[model samples]
Target chain A: MKFKTLVRPLLVATAAVGATAVAQPAAKPSPEGVATAAQNVIIDRALLTAFKALPSRFEDAKNPITAEKVELGRMLYFDTRLSKNQDLSCNSCHDLNTFGVDNKPTSTGHKKQLGGRNSPTVYNAGGHTTQFWDGRAANLEEQAKGPILNPVEMAMPSADHVVATIKSIPGYVTAFQKSFPGEADPVTYDNLAKAIGAFERQLVTPSRFDKFLGGDDKALTQVEKAGLKTFLDQGCQTCHYGPALGGSLQKLGLVVPYQAKDQGRFDLTKKESDRMVFRVPTLRNVAKTGPWFHDGSITELQTAVKLMAQHQLGKQLTDTDAKQILAFLDSLTGELPKGYIAKPKLPPSGPKTPKPDPT
Target chain B: MKFKTLVRPLLVATAAVGATAVAQPAAKPSPEGVATAAQNVIIDRALLTAFKALPSRFEDAKNPITAEKVELGRMLYFDTRLSKNQDLSCNSCHDLNTFGVDNKPTSTGHKKQLGGRNSPTVYNAGGHTTQFWDGRAANLEEQAKGPILNPVEMAMPSADHVVATIKSIPGYVTAFQKSFPGEADPVTYDNLAKAIGAFERQLVTPSRFDKFLGGDDKALTQVEKAGLKTFLDQGCQTCHYGPALGGSLQKLGLVVPYQAKDQGRFDLTKKESDRMVFRVPTLRNVAKTGPWFHDGSITELQTAVKLMAQHQLGKQLTDTDAKQILAFLDSLTGELPKGYIAKPKLPPSGPKTPKPDPT
Candidate 1:
């Protein structure tokens, strides 16, 4: 069946409904968009039909992501003093603006030191099975701790220091008690990471890709559909499958040697076979995060796609193929989190030389 | 008066109310918090007092910036394919995710050519009297058209091409007709610019700074308040005044000679006097847009501050002064536009190839 032909009927139906709404509004017109009696009848019938089609609330057991936790996480993420040097926070790299990743080749960390890996986007990270390039962490909780203690990242001296910092803040102490009851130390470093992890788990971005996946056939354009087909045909889906589309762990070089001289998982496992293995990063928001890869060598999406195809697939992709894939990738950008991107609150005093953590 | 002393009484009042509520709820406790009833009473009293204070709704007009023309202008500002190559959109550079600007040192344009200047944010562009680095456009409407036809920016062949492109799209045709009726060509390039301008006018980002401005003494922390004082004392407010701080036009190097080779306003006007003259961009949302300035040579806010102090003010600013100014600047970041950051619905087939304008 022709795509245009199928769309024509839907367009006609919409036009008919619009016409009826306009015509009926002339008689006994109401304020606002509230319909008149005749219009209401039609509207009610349509609403009823839609309601019937909707799945039961229990069947769709998606719990609401709380606003309080999001608010807390946002505050924690932006608090620069969380770092050992009192310079970095989660937001230093994963900015709410700029597509949730700092667009640097590699992110700067403690004392302006560059990290080895490109900062992946925090967007839709909730949907991924594991976090980070190495995939050492089982969840965002583990991932959060890795950055805080990592000498190259936030570079916090110890978890005890983090706990001490939180304990010192009266407001944070009160908040911690509220968030976690019956705990010896609710404001401990572990709890802080856990709270942040809870917030990160709620960052599931609903995009056009998800809309297409949810049976909205018309959600994507022709070029994007073509790219999807090409991606599948090229065997890119062999590893990058499921909702996250390659968040699951996989061998870095499926068909070719993993270049860049980085032993991805070997450092963690000390196993020869794990040398080139790495977590398959979710393609959910790949377009927004540039300077791709663990080393952040690739700048453009096209360059990344070409390199991935050549190195992993052992196949050359045309420019047109890369463009199509980019289009599809662009469709993955979802809405920004509501009320998350806000002006930073100024501290009570000017940049104070804090008395160093006694701990 | 000490802040703690003032708050102590309020805390005592709150505790009394909280105690009463807790006691009453013990037998048949409400699931709501102990403070809920007290909060409700306080809100009710406050509303009554406010109404008594200002009897007329007109006196207490809380209606924010709402101009139809401005809304229309914003729509045009966001629309892609305004360029001759039909590749670049307003969002290509001034993305919502990046608080407005694309956060690149300089954004790429049509045919993947690099633009000389970094894209400034449109967050509080409405507050500006003149627009752009050179202050060439008198208002946003004029600014909206400049980029559409700029060879280095969108690179649209001509205004005629833009008009024709809008006329061809059925959705645009209907929208233009509705927005501007009884016109020879409602979908003209001018109207397109006007629509975008209208939308831009509505993009007012309310922030904690506004609350402080509105006489909320406690709205800002002591540090931010001190920063504000330092900013005013440093004579930064001489040019960067009014609601849209620094929207007014000023010579770029008022206190010093032009350091950069780029001819600023001289390129636009061909007048020697106009050399290095540029619009003082609004400080609103400055935190989100990095790699700041017309040339985007500066990356950090502190660096920009230090340079501004050295050149514009002709005084070496202390590190303390720089930090305070940065704190003040951070407070200028505001809320994102409602519903503007939503993930867009892709065309059903997928991402589409660029097509020629039907008109």
Candidate 2:
């Protein structure tokens, strides 16, 4: 199906060359990153129509969200006792307080070992088509089980150990019973993932960009609107679209080659098509997240913008254009849910709980 | 559809890591590129079940290949009247005498202009899923119409001009009538393409590998079999499978980043996922098709094999391994269909036929 529209009747190659000619040169933004009165540029609202406002919750029929499950999941998310060393939790890397990331190039895990890829932010991740840099996981529930047992991550040893840890905590047992009522036995590993996934489902953050999409044009500044127009004109929306601005998997470099040690999805799939293919991270609160790309090699937002244009869009963006795009990206910063993400009191470990295994 | 299998249940990433660890090291072949008695390596024929022997003719229901069409197409394929300057034809670049390639990194076209990408061989091309390095053309019929009108290639002004030229040649009219039979108007541009496509359909060359695949174990040397086994074990079969050893679109670099100016399919599609994606060239007559890859930057077959291992397979192939793979590739060199592809006499241009325009 991907090859369907490409098989044109005639003159497709010529038309493609025309497109390359038109889009190769990025439009120069006015000084101060604002549209000049002389310029008189009016960006069509339809260009922004590709994007949708963030939902209140990313609901899944398989794992329905409940107040009890959300609360228990929040506790489990922050519980360090789930790890082999009883030091690292999901929060140790994806800290919800800091917009769901520890801001490390690669997250430190068991024995202070680093992961191969940069730790992607968890905020707005439930809305993604798939999870992880390599897209190794399908959804939040499926992704929740990986790092807990990874040798370089939480290093919990086994699913049985994780289940036993939860069961040994009397408070968690009661919480699980309430969360999964009518089930003869609770506190199972699968149910535990479901609970954490339920909490993650509500991790949406709405921003001024969403307000603009909701017909509140005045929510964004004039410069930001100019930047938005630039974003659309440069064809950045081809990959970075949808509710989260980006969630689908796309190649790292589109126009110019990008040198990266990590082969992304190819490392997992071994399929030639999957090489350098990575899930496009959401732009929501992008300004708050630092060290961009799969390797987190880029530190400056302007540099990231410049590289994206050069490598992905085949455009040599002017400094003003990069800054304007950065201004537009800055508008994506949203207010985090304070009370919803607040760390809950973890259940005390029972006498039967296994001690932290340093080995 | 692409995302289906990727949404795994559990332990997918861990298992993927295991695969990476195991396959990262490419096996070194024997010093003499032959299987040693001590090595005791027996290549199972079943491992090559993915590949099928080359068909006699790549048939298409749309354009049935007949003797009349084949003869007419042979003339049209070699006729220089198809170009604006009357100096170039399909054979100008895809020379039939040289395994259907000019051996240039990129072909010199209209007014000595060079095309952006390498000109792939025409042999076994009819069996490809799609045509062109970017796969813009669906089949040989569609692909036949491209270069003639491309400004840098044959550079015919328009389809109408092409039709008028064919109509002017009295001998071509008779040939077209014979080729088309019941058609009221036989000398059209579409029919011209169909005629050329019909000629190209029978371009398949049967190699010794086909004999080996047909259960003739002695058809291949022991060294070739060792190379074939190495090819299978190195996971070259992932993309380079099927009858032609390859015919699908795959990322140019699956394990390591390959720096290339040409963005491949992305230059046309402008989709982020299409970046660095190119149609995998068939290995049917691979040893004969020199100056490899989309850009044709690589010259030696050994270097190309080594790079494929490093970039696509994440393997550091030993010298012996590269040589062994080359030996296997040599077995793919099939005998050319000399009588079938023999150039036919083209009809003389009529007085009313348009003159070659240099400007």
Candidate 3:
């Protein structure tokens, strides 16, 4: 049956569990003639089969994550020296402490210049199909290489210069040999990206939503579950389904066109059909990493929810529906891996290391 | 992006991998004038984010799987005495060796009477959102109880009679007590179902598709991968997705009305909208568990694929496309848990145990 037809039958309107503390939205008199506690909505748990719990980490056999490699990558991720003036590291924009985002509309980069697109949170990014709003990079390894060379970003002149910087750091040289055992030349730019990618790959966060998906119905409040129902019923899941909630690239203005200067993927592909196509951003940690959308034009989560429904699904969401959906999205805020993301002490720069160039 | 529009660009037409020695449909000569090796087709790995690797087991915290309970369930699964005639067991229909199916269109039960519908495979059943074709049972535990008392099935007179039969057997009494510790009387129907459910919970089969999903590009043959692309491109994954490939209840004959005598879930709900609704069967081990469909009427895999496409998707699949999809379906054939499913030696029946009732 179509989702709309089964909606009333599938949902069992019952008193919510563990929601007594919550203010009652619609309280009624009990059989005993006393005001009842807050009511909780219950949807058929079976509908949740559309989602899966986040895996411990997204594993890739090609880049086998080892202790040596992850440690080396962790150091490289924090070392700002990889940049031209030794000022910007991967962590500078994708800050580990701040849920892998700097919480900026567009990230500040080389020489305090701003990037064109919003920097997405690196958390759970390994599970994404592709990286960036335009999806130019295929995997984490390929994505790690882009920002380092971009003029407005890290501003490293070339791969050789980046490799030389790492080679000059005596500690990184030893770390590289250990990380990539038996390699003829280990301190290459490729290995640097690989090491960084390996670390980023393990950056996963487990949230309350995962607990709910893992068969714990009590993990989410009744309101949150209702909000989830609203989100699903609204067809947000058309583009936002899966462990990461959203990873597939989709047409931004699918039903109703939005006013936008950026052509999105069309700027890269130069194909008319590619116009306004962007990778659907993951809803994981979405509550934390806001200043929303490709251009970070909408700061309020409520506005983003309403516009998405309007432009993508051709549905108008009431303020009440948007609020409920926000409550559901708030449950997606995950606990970060504290020890795993801790900033490590970088190795000392060698005497022969290139001096910082302000140019 | 629409899947159809992205298809040609997302897929890179190439030679099939590891397909040598097999007859090639259209083999071309190399520039060196030598016949080329088997060709492999490659699709964008990004599209595969739709699928997830199956977990080792679908864990339910409510009914935890323990060694004692599983062992008890193993014996119960094979014990024919549970049936009124002492001629059948759970394994009589869901044969473990044959991918949890009897290979019959529908199973014969009490007095050799055939059931109304095909007996679906029990493998990976715990991952399903709901149990049975009509989704009458909510979980494996609930599903375990239905056939035991059904007049056409095991045909035990009542739940009390079933409990009394178990209580009479000294081994079962002791086993139940051990499985459900601290209970004053443990040899009850509810505990019996829980034990069986616990055993069934771990009945997972890991397949090559899982390996492919876990970032191993070469896990599937080139033909299999292409077949997967064809499957995805056709939008089969809309109903057949997640770790189990399918578990959701969907409307059968979505685009085209099927010629059917059965009302499916409509019989249970008595609602007009539920006329042709049925729980979408899991595709895991589906290649082995056929004679397919609710009535098992369609015997050939090719014919079933064609009918499903025509009726549900409203698309006519060419013979080549159907054959390619079959290759992909073959990849879903998972390795059965041989050691786990091995029938245990049933305990001796006690003196007061009721005799098999033929009438």
Candidate 4:
């Protein structure tokens, strides 16, 4: 269920962006092909200092990786029986196929309830400073536990209900046992989160930009290379840097203040400093994961680009500048690991498997 | 999207059924160990005449099968982007991983809307005479078109919307082109249904029963063989006689009228002869798919077994008979095709892709 193309130019806002003059950049020459000597040096140095190529997998400290656990996690990821309605699994929102998102402004949840925030892409998320927009959860494993219990999300009655559901499916019983050996009762809710996190860790997608970071000068095209220079020159790299290209914390409105229904980290910590402060999202698949921003209100990459520069960088990006960066962002689109994300065949429900509860 | 896995026994109801006398099934001697000479001959002859081993694949006459087409269909099968919510796909209801069923008494649809009927197993649906509970569609291809447009199912607004959605994905353009060569426009609504139907054809599950039908007598355990005898002797074979074990149409209340909100095939054709008649469902994965009956009113297999006898055959199944028959039914559990149903990597949505409409 994981190998979906995350390219989301089909997003409604993208069309709105595409309709603008910046949709097709009309630079004098391609950014890559015409970069000045000074620009090239800045591009090379900036990439070397702030970024590293994405790795194929991210390692979790607590839950060691194993083929068995990953396989089990894959099944759980696709099993809709996890939700109270039996219609949603982890994949329902963080869909592996669509670059790990449902591509909604805010994801629709149980009973079709909409969430308050847009879903972050699961791809390459293991490298995040913290999971979720507010960073309330410390890691992917901790984040995995939240949704099943969230009234608007997967909505399992309780952790016990989830554990009991897994216990009812005999295959899951054996899978849990195999995934977590040496335990007397292996199918606990915590272990379920661990398994899903383990599977998610394998979702790291390395785009061509990673190859450039790996010192492949020819990996990106001329226009893309120029776009990279513009990206760094504009100070977008301050918070957006690293193997994931933005696994750090930053204020949502850095140089300028922004308003929204959510107060970002302020909601979690209830601290003035944390207000509007969000864990900076990875730019890895940003093109495929729009409408952009915390609220997912901006669909057009140009608009998102302009807004970010204005609110966060305090600089107005020209049409050519926005177009160039959009080209560079396009370089972040990565190849889906063919077989790794292939949907696993979930076990048949056992005689004791729980019935879906619509109520 | 959650309404599934109404497996009563694995469910708390499964415990209730498991607690029944049939749970232990105490006959003076085991039905298997002490089968009479007359029972052996009848079981052998009836199986030979009425049942054939399940075929590896069911061929379609209108939509010729191909590797390319099936591959594309597999992607479409797992793609929730096909639905209006971008949260429901063909896999949402007929999941290939769980024996091709969501296992709901009634499947949940877009916005967590509920459907009226139980989701049938897609495992061997191709072998059936018609599709759906009422035989409204003539074959799997036609049947494949229903749920996407059903307001209560995947809830795609229109077939054109579905086609446009598929068209928005750039990879689908190449895929449809490759899958249907020489076509001016390959990504049509009809072709989408055909591609999906092509994939569904490969969902055949071959169990021990198929091996037994292939003339491997030893494949049947002593108890299973006894159950087969009981299955045939009780006249359950009349409508259930096919490679699918039950593809023929049958009256819902042959012996006595059964009451339900849904009036079976009468809703589809509005013909008096078709009243109370439904296409006999395949028993292929009956054990895996629960909340039995059209309305999914029953969850326990034992009760479903008992009800079929009383309502459809006008016979009372003793605890011993139902237990022995259930043991036989267990033999029908087949191996899922390892990689055939593996979720495909859907193409990325393209620039022209339509945005999801939550409303």
Residues B1-359, candidate 1: write the lDDT tens digits.
11221112111111212222212111222223322221211110110110111111111011122344444444556567576665667878888767888989898977777987888887777666567887767666678878778777788778877776666666667667767867866877767777776666556677777776655666666656546644643446545654667665555544323346676766776543345656776787787788877788877778777666443443345566667667778878877766665434322211332364422
lDDT of 3: 0.76
Q: Is the docking of candidate 3 incorrect, acceptable, medium or high quality?
A: incorrect
TM values, all candidates: 0.41, 0.50, 0.64, 0.46
Q: What tens-digit string does per-residue lDDT give for candidate 1 at A133-177? A: 867775676777888888888888888877777666666776677
* Candidate 2 global lDDT: 0.76
DockQ of 3: 0.08
Which candidate tops DockQ?
3
**Residue-by-residue lDDT tens digits, candidate 2, B1-359:** 01211122211111222222222223323465445511434455534544779999899999999999988888999999999999998988998889999898899998999997788999989877778998888789999999999999999999999999999999999999999999999889899999999999989989999999999988888878778866765557655766787766665653333556787777887654456667889998888888888887777888888777655544556778777788899999998999866667778889999998887
On residues A210-285, what C-alpha lDDT tens digit does candidate 3 reach at each position? 9988888888887687678667655566567667887766657543344467777768876443467678899998
Q: Residue-wise lDDT of candidate 4 within A155-204, one digit each (tens)?
A: 89899999988988889999999999999989999999999999889998
Off by over 4 Å in 2: A1-41, B1-359
Ranking by TM-score: 3, 2, 4, 1
